[model samples]
Target: MTLSENGDLWCDIRTLHPAGNHPALFLDRDGTLIELVDYLSDPAAVVLIGSVLEDIWQANKDGHAVVIVTNQSGIGRGYYRWADFHAVQARLYDLLAAEDLVIDATYACPHPPPDAGGPAHSLYRKPAPGMLTRAADDLNLDLSRSRILGDSVSDLAAGKAAGLPVGILVSDGYGARDAEAARVLADDGFEVIRR
Candidate 1:
């Protein structure tokens, strides 16, 4: 069966039904939290980024919901299957849990590119506010206070489109190159920090 045959949206809630209207730190998986690996599908290859470990811990302590928003195009493109994705994610969760870092929720969009003859560009992919907006509604989060943290310009674009006030572009993955283009999105209270 194809990835789209399973569904278009993938959501996993780790919290025991968290109360709504909380501020969230919407994080990206690959290149943002973990080391960048092109279409990574192996659990053993997972490696956490040390730079944001403290920030994640602080967000939890500060009463912010730690959420992950990822685009797993590899799944839809036949590079990996859902089981592989779960295995990789389980590794990530295990590593974070070891540090006492809890993720409130996780969302993934398994839409393939147009070349795959599918509408992967629907509402849930990055650069579009679908996943973030859905997370806000599902978790009852306040978008105005939420922040998107990723290494791509798409993260900043999505945050701004979602009306989020902050977007952190880290130099972990593609941030160093995307930084120049992301500078323009840092207006009207939508702060874009290129680190």
Candidate 2:
């Protein structure tokens, strides 16, 4: 993982293969690509969900940039440090490399909600488009043709706010308990994938 001068943590897949102005697959980290663990701070706990690797591989093959946008409020809540997050991310990168899957970039928001007292809710957090917009600019991604995939409503909402065309909700992680809400999002044009 490389930290760009702009402060984005990225894998820089362009070095391995060139892709220009492609649509992106914006993904939520926890509960989307990996099993959800509350305040997960251990690198050893990184576990990829069965379908995510294949799906990400397919997206890569199809020339789509895969970028992870996650909300890590645990940091703001003092449950974990930034170093812990980096350790977990490094482990995740190693695991994905073993599968021949590469993520183009990762953006995270560490701010907590107003009620949590970390700070005012950040625009970079889910349900907001700041992170996606920054990724699009930095990566030269086409937002209109992009899609977001994850296990929570906020992920879909972020995609929508970013002006992306589609959002897919996978029925795993937090999504399992949000079936009804998922259906509601589907009615609003989001895709709900039962896994």
How much lDDT does each candidate structure score?
0.86, 0.79
> How high a TM-score does candidate 1 get?
0.93
lDDT of 1 by residue, 28-117 (tens): 888999999989999999999999888899989988888898989898788998889888989999999999999888888887656775
Candidate 2 lDDT, tens digit per residue, 69-147? 9988888788998789989988998999999998878888776766887556466777788889988887788998999
- Relative to the true structure, candidate 2 has a C-alpha RMSD (angstroms) of 3.0
In model 2, the Cα lDDT at residue 20 comes to 67
Cα-based lDDT at residue 123, candidate 1: 84
lDDT of 1 at 157: 91
**Against the hidden reference, what TM-scores do the models get?**
0.93, 0.86
Q: Backbone clash tally for model 2?
A: 0
What is the clash count for each candidate, in the order shown?
1, 0
lDDT of 2: 0.79
Q: Which residue pairs show backbone clashes in model 2?
A: none
Candidate 1: residue 36 lDDT (0-100): 93
> What CA RMSD would you report for each candidate?
2.6, 3.0
On lDDT, the leading prediction is 1
